[model samples]
Each structure stands twice: as structure tokens, then as C-alpha cells.
Target chain A: MDRYAPPGAGSAAGAERPQAEVRVPEIPGLPAGIPDGGDAPARHEGGEGDAAAPEAELTPPSAGDRPAQGKSPFQALTVIGQIEGHVSLPSQNKTTRYEHVLPQLIAIEQDPEVQGLIVLLNTVGGDVEAGLAIAEMIRSMSKPTVSVVLGGGHSIGVPIAVAVDRSFIVSTATMTIHPIRLSGMVIGIPQTYEYLDKMQDRVVHFVVANSRISQERYRELMFRTGELARDVGTILVGRDAVREGLIHEVGGMAQALASLRAMVRQGGRHQR
Target chain B: MLYSIIPPEVVLRPADGPAAVLWEEVEASGARRLILRRDADGRVVIERIISTEPRDYLDPALQPGQPYHPGRRE
Candidate 1:
């Protein structure tokens, strides 16, 4: 009876009580000596509670949990659908409101833990002012930034794609370079044409200033005829965009992230 | 003025009628403010989460287009 008592329970009182040997259900993959919950002594030392502690330490918290600690240092901002400006488009039309993006950009810039930013663009573009405003924000951000043109980055998206520290375009992506034009009823006055030309100049200057494309070549792409069936513009695909000096490289996500990480490391060294 | 590759005719097309969608802002758990709207199937769907905390954006449950049930704690 004394020999039957557990090593921890080594008293006459322990020997008097019935030592019911409890057995844990054998699970296939689990080790043989898993203690049953009803067994107090074994549970206290190496039971469910003790088992869970090491597992919690081994596995990181999921994204749904407190992700701030476990999240990646770099943040990704996707600019897809239409770049919605002042007016909200119909619900059917997918739009990326500037109001939403602007605030998020501010937050990203302010987050000290965030090391860098990667802007993924697949926009058909929208209002010139709104696009330029977004472009300016990305350009002015002190943190290392990179933009990747995935599907298409046409018209106003061109400026935004080039606004980053380095830009990459997937091999199949296409970018349309065309002059800005009024959508609704336009009063056919000389002033209206001048206003349109001035707006176009703004986009041209922004692209030329931030990219390797010369002003003349960009303008040629904008005003070139016989390219689009209806409109006058040049459709640059992948390497053509890199060759035109608009996008920095013609690679996908891998190149973009690698370049951004390198830039972030370099920036961190500089700050240190 | 718009500068897009999409045609002006398609881009500026007028809506058939005013949207009848109902949007409501509700206070969710963890001090999160969520803008919700009912979908076609009558499930309350998340339109957006309005919070200054950047960490809120990382929450998968609070992402846009996800269904939101009131009084349910995840």
C-alpha cells in the first residue's frame, strides 16, 4: 500500500485512501504518458495548463489577434479600382476614395514601428487634382517607399507609380499615356482649352521631375496618334515603360520588396 | 477634368436611381467603431471601421466586406 502511493504523497494518510489509477485516453499521435485532467498531481506539473504555455510561446499570435507586435515592419497600400476624388462614384463602380487613402497614408507615415511602404497600383485613374495630390503625398513621405504597377496604371496612375523611390511594373501590365480631358459638358471656349493644357502640364512636369523620362518623350507619348482606336495616346507595356524611363524596372513583387527592404536597411543605417 | 484610359461615356454614366442602401455606425467591442450596411441577403456587412488606432486595420474581422453580427464577441 505504501509503495502504491505517489512519490509526492508519502504519508500514512495517503496510503489509507484508495489510489484509483486514472488512465488518459490514448490519442494516436500524442505521446503515451499524457496525464488525465482528473489527476491533480500530474496535471499541476505537466498538464493542459503547462502544455499550453510552451505552445503559446512557440506559435505567434494570428493576424486577428493583437497584430501590432507580430505584424510585418513594412506596410502595403493597395490602390485599386478607380481613384475616387471629391465626388463619390456610384456603388457599382469600384472606387478608392482619396479621403480614406489620405488619412491612411498619414497614419502609415506617423507609425514609428513601420519601416517602409509599398504601394500596389491597379487603377484606371481618376481626377487629375486628386491623383496628383496622392502622388505628392507619396513623393513627400520621408520613409522608404516603392510602387508596383500590377495590372494597369493608366493616365494619372503614371504619376503615382513614379512618385515612389523606385517603381516596378509586372511584365504584362499596361500603362496608357494620354492628355487629360474634361468629362462632362465643356464650354467650347479658348480658356477651357488653356485650362486643360495647364492641367496636362502639371501631370507632365510631375512625371518628368520624378522619373527618367524626358519631357519631350512623355509629351510625344501623350499626344501620339494612331495608337488607341479612338483616343490619341501610347500604350506602354512592361519593358516599354522601363525603356521609356517612366518606371524604374520591369519586375514583379519579389524585386519590389527586395529593393524596398534594402532601402529601408540603408535608411536605418543613416538614421543610426 | 478626368484623366483615365476608360472612355468618358462609360466613366460618367448616370446611376439608374438613388442608392437605397442603409448605412449605420455601430460601436463594436474593443472600442471599435464600425460602419455597417445590410447586404442583399440582409446580413449586416462591414463597410469600414472608423478608428484612429492603426492597429485596428490589422484586425481581420474588422476588414471591409466582412459580415458583422451585433452583440457577438469574437
Candidate 2:
């Protein structure tokens, strides 16, 4: 080891992976090399707790693919489709399950070779709990993380997009921020309304805390009635997203990757 | 230090005229396309960003059941 080597360099080997494993992982169409078997060790927290079922029982063979397994110093996570939580969505509907994401995050957190994370989101937004849980996991990661919004990151996707250390969006990508919605049976109860308000509070607080937007201002956008036809909330375009302070910049993938690399370089100095 | 962008490399145009071009290593996030086209004044100026799409990954031996697809190039 060099006399001035970084702090974690020596210890990184403990978590080393095959060199062919590039760390840019975010729910690939199919994840290879995962030890999917009846004897697969007990899945840690966020495993969705259904390891006993046969592989066919899982939603799509790709849902739990381990694309994140690589020896590189960076990892990419894609928060696409609707985020599925306690209940799995239909197989046909695109989804980012919390179960799959949770373990990957843990690996990224523990892996020494992995230094940073990139979150790519193109979700219409799915279950609130699942989305929020993913966002919280990402925001709490010790390694620096950045998010890029391609296409539309609507509804709860708003929280995930803003959760990163830095954010980027293409000139044409847009994000929609509407009040939360519920699809199932509705009892006209006071507690139900209160629960809704609290849920809204969680999303609003997270977005405001991570980004430059103000609390009242965010709510104002959330409740705005005219921007979206037949829906409330404001629609922010590429530059508009930057102006509103939800995302850090109005740039594309290169900018986001550059930012992540820069953060990792800084981390190299500090040796975090 | 790692964040430093890859420098652009100069490539001469394949025409009989006295023209040259500069190209950047573009990424899928779309921030690429900083082509340095020389203007009439013999000075280079930013022309336009050509494309900003994610590149595809293909493998001939990849089987259908395997997790084989052209993923993000960057």
C-alpha cells in the first residue's frame, strides 16, 4: 500500500467482487449470478419475506435480478414503473419492488468496492409506502447518491427524485406533483382524512427538507388546481424543475455522472 | 478529480475541403454533443448537440432465459 493511500482502500478487498461485474446496477431486465435456491440464505430485512416460494412464484424472473453486483466503485439504481410494496402489482404492470431494492441497498452500503450510487427514475409512481421506503433508504445511504429523472417522475416519485445528493433532468423530462391518491374502498371516516393528511405531510417534508423548495410553496404546488387537467399539483419541465429547486440542475446523464464522480473523488480525499 | 470530463478529441472531416471537427464522449443522460464547428471567421464555435440517447448493449451469445439485454452503456 502507498504511504498516502486513502482510508478504505485496504479494507475494500473484503467486499471485492468479480471485475466483470460493473457496478452500474439498477434493476436490469435480467439479473445474473444471484444464488436463487431453496437453500438461499435467509434474506435480510426488506427481503419481502417470501424466499420459500419457487422461482416461478416470483412476479417476473427479473424482479429480483442482482444487476447491482459488480466490482466497480459506483452503483446505479433504477426506480422505474410503479413501486410495489406489501402487495405485488400485476405481473404485466412495470414495478420496482421494495423487497429487491432493500437488499441491493444493503449490499451497496456494505460493499467496499462500491463508493457512490446513481438513481434513475422513470416511474408513474406506485404504492406510497414502497416509494417512500425506497426514498428513505436512498437518502440515508452513507455513500453519496445522485438521481436523474428521465421521462416523468410523478406522484410519490417526487420524493425519490429529490432524495439524492444531486439531481439532473434532460431538457424535455417532466415531473408531476399531485396530492396522494387511494384506489381501494373508502370509508367516509374522519380518521381516514387525518391519515391522508399525515401521509401528505411525510412526502412534503421529505421533498422540502432535501431540496430547496419551501414547505408552503411545495404544498401550494401540490394543491394547485389548474396545471394538470382533471388533477391537482404542478407540472415542472426540465428547466422548471431546476428553477423550482426540486432538482439541482437542468442537465443530462453526463452531468449527473460527472457530479457523482466528483463526489466520489471528494470522498476519496476524506476516505469515507 | 474523478469528475473531470473526458477531453474532446479532434477529428478532421473526411471532405476535400479544409474542415476539421471535435467530438466528445457522450453519455445517455443527454449532456453530450458539444461539436466544435469552425465558423467563417476561422474560429471554432459551439454548433449543436447531435444526440443524447442511452446506448444499447448487445451480445450474440446471450440466451432468451438468461438476463441478456443491451443495458445502459454509461
For TM-score, the strongest prediction is 1
Question: How high is the CA lDDT of each candidate model?
Answer: 0.67, 0.56
DockQ of each: 0.08, 0.02
Alpha-carbon DockQ of candidate 1: 0.08
User: How do all models score by TM-score?
Assistant: 0.71, 0.61
- What CAPRI-style quality would you assign to candidate 1? incorrect
Q: What is candidate 1's lDDT per residue for A1-272, written digit by digit as tens? A: 00111212333222332333222222121122111211111110111111111111112213344333533567777777777665544344566656656766786787787777888899898878889999999888888888899999999999999999989999999999998876566668999888888999999999999999999999999989999997889999999999999998999889988988898877741111
**Candidate 1: residue A114 Cα off by (Å):** 0.5
Worst-scoring 10-residue span by lDDT in model 2 chain A: A1-10
C-alpha displacement of B13 in model 2, angstroms?
56
Interface RMSD of each: 25.4, 24.8
**Clashing pairs in model 2?**
A21-A70, A25-A76, A253-B29, B57-B70
Clashing pairs in 1: none
Compared with the true structure, what per-residue lDDT tens digits does model 1 show for residues B1-74?
56887765676554343244444444443323465544555455667765534556867767887766433432
Whole-model lDDT, candidate 1? 0.67
- lDDT per residue, candidate 2, A117-202, as tens digits? 88888877766777888899988888888889998787788889988888888878889877765433475998987887888888
